[model samples]
Target: MQDNDITVLVVEDDDIDYMTVKRSFSKRKIMNPMVRAIDGVEALELLKGKKIGYPYIILLDLKMPRMGGLEFLEKLRADSELKDTVVFVLTTSKDEDDIHYSYEKNVAGYFLKEEASDSMMSLVDMLDGYWRIVQFPTK
Candidate 1:
């Protein structure tokens, strides 16, 4: 894959979860860059950076400190610059409201964290395929 094939930004607060994701990516031999943010605020700042680069997919955790995922999504969705970025909520929440709200905000996908790691890997692989093989509108 080219350097710009797909960049992933993982917005998660839990350190353990972050490590798990890293380990999973390594185990699966994923070659894509995986940027990380501990909270929504940091994620936004990172996304706004001039040199950080575009994130093809965001693995978001809904419940986080320094602004939750929903609030972050609301702000991002309303922003003209970031509205088109693909966001995928990866959370443990099974709440109907969370799901509905995330979808309403135009998230590209949602996945339960408790599901098997293999399932998560499958999604990541699919995402890689989409971003690497499919043509998307570029800036």
Candidate 2:
């Protein structure tokens, strides 16, 4: 990957959902490297350990086995080194409280899984366009 390429960290526990995302990216010919985590705990390990490259964005799911997306966001925002990280929530939850709290934690955007159930084209396209034009702070 190029230095400017934005790595996508997908924190999803469901195998089907993860495959759907991968298929979408493949179909769209999105070349950015993707990193997967089964849950928030693993996601934290990657981020805190700097396993993924800089200029990355997280596509977070709200429900999971260990730590859910909200808790991950809480820890992410609290960490001085990662507070500025950008996150977008993608989940099956339509709960109003989930939406409210996700934004409260400063997620860049929130999308329901139903929106991308077919091909995930919409989400993939948006992310493609996003990383193309967005800027990140230098470390």
Candidate 3:
């Protein structure tokens, strides 16, 4: 479940942001499999029936079409099966309400997209070590 061994599902709607992350990964030489979902609906659909190995972390955006991040989080949290999955809000929003709400939802972390860019590789590297030691349930 190392960073490279973990699958990162990025639930972001912005094309530019998606590309930025992609490019950053390449530049940083992160070997993890990265999945992209344009919105909440698509993200959920992509997750259906997927049996990903544990220590998987979700990089979620708070705003999008079909369903916003908060709504998505609510629904995701409601499902017992997905409750243990770790999620971090990776967004451009600096709004206090958004931050508070995400934390209230029990998100593992709240990361600002802009600030994250500066040390994206470092963060990914750190995740590599931690994920390798963690475990998740499988059905």
Candidate 4:
């Protein structure tokens, strides 16, 4: 399927999880470009340096080294240029605080990665629909 113009920026630490997401999209024939960053630090650099363009959405994982998703969200929101960037929390963490804090950071949505492959497949399907109708801020 052809995505309008949305690119998925996946900020994940685990290789297996990352591959799971990629496989889901591939299986569905979704053609949206996927950029992967192992952790929040690299994710920030990618955003700051213009590696990934505007009109993109981030799929963030909560637990990661160097800087976790929450800290990244803090920095993202604090920056005037990147403050309004859309983010979706996709993590295995189901803690109450993580959920509450993620939404507090203005994340578009939150998803749990419980079943790994199956969950990722469902998540991919949902995201396909989301980007289809959603108009991202073009910075």
Candidate 5:
């Protein structure tokens, strides 16, 4: 798999955070297409309705207005069709419970949002490398 072969779904309610992701991707030269959802409910709608393609990864935030990341993960895991979807938790929450629950729900990784722009850039670079080498199940 290559970077262009995968899509990224970012579920975040904060506009600044979303922009940060975009900026980081740009800074890292990660050209993969990115889709945004304001919350878990919207993300679910997008996924369940086939609004997005396969071989995509999700960047999920734990806090939101309508539905949260944990709730979203529960729902996603319950649905057999989406159970294997790759998800990574990106949030400001440093709470141990949040970390544990996110891992319990099978997130690919959990990252804190307190890092600077440079950190985000590094994250995008790492993800780009990961998508290039990692193989995902075909739809």
Candidate 6:
């Protein structure tokens, strides 16, 4: 699949972080469509609805006002339809337990939010290259 064929579902509550990601995408010229959710509950709603298409990757944050990322991952994994969805944890939490739990839930990767914007741009670049070569299951 091509990079444009992949969508990014950013499940985060921090306005700054969200904007940072948006800025990073813009700076890197990553034109992939992006959808934002304030928390896990909203993310789930969007996923269950038809607003976003398949072959999407989730950039999930672990902490939020409502349902947290781990809770969301649990619910998501329980659902057969969404269990195989690709998810990457992007959060400020550096707790080992959080990392363990996220990996246990089968996240694609875990990243710290303290990373520099240059790092973020690199991440976007990597993701663009990744989606271009990887294949996602048809929904």
lDDT of each: 0.82, 0.90, 0.78, 0.88, 0.92, 0.90
Q: Judging by lDDT, tell me the better candidate of 4 and 6.
A: 6
lDDT of 3 by residue, 1-139 (tens): 2336678888999998888877877876777788888888887776665744444678899889899899888888888878667897888789999999998889988877765566666655556565767676554
Clashes of 5: 0
> TM-scores across all candidates?
0.89, 0.94, 0.84, 0.93, 0.96, 0.95
lDDT of 6 by residue, 1-139 (tens): 5668788999999999999999988887889899999999999999888577778999999999889999999999998888999999998999999999999999999988876677677678778778888888777
Which prediction has the highest lDDT against the true structure?
5
For model 2, how big is the CA root-mean-square deviation? 1.8
Quick one: how many clashes does candidate 2 have? 0
Cα distance off (Å), candidate 2, residue 46: 0.9
Model 2 residue pairs with clashes: none
For model 3, the stretches where C-alpha displacement exceeds 4 angstroms are 1-3, 51-55, 137-139
The candidate with the higher lDDT, 5 or 6, is: 5
Q: Which ten residues in a row have the lowest lDDT in candidate 2?
A: 114-123
lDDT of 4 by residue, 1-70 (tens): 2355688899999999898888889998998889999999999999999899557889999999999999
**TM match of model 5 to true structure:** 0.96
lDDT of 1 by residue, 1-112 (tens): 3635577889999998888788877776878788888998998898777345654678899999998999999988888888888888989999999999999999988888
Root-mean-square deviation per candidate: 1.9, 1.8, 2.4, 1.8, 1.0, 1.1
Candidates 2 and 4 compared by lDDT, better number: 2
Predicted structure 2, TM vs. truth: 0.94
Q: What is the lDDT of candidate 6?
A: 0.90
Off by over 4 Å in 1: 1-4
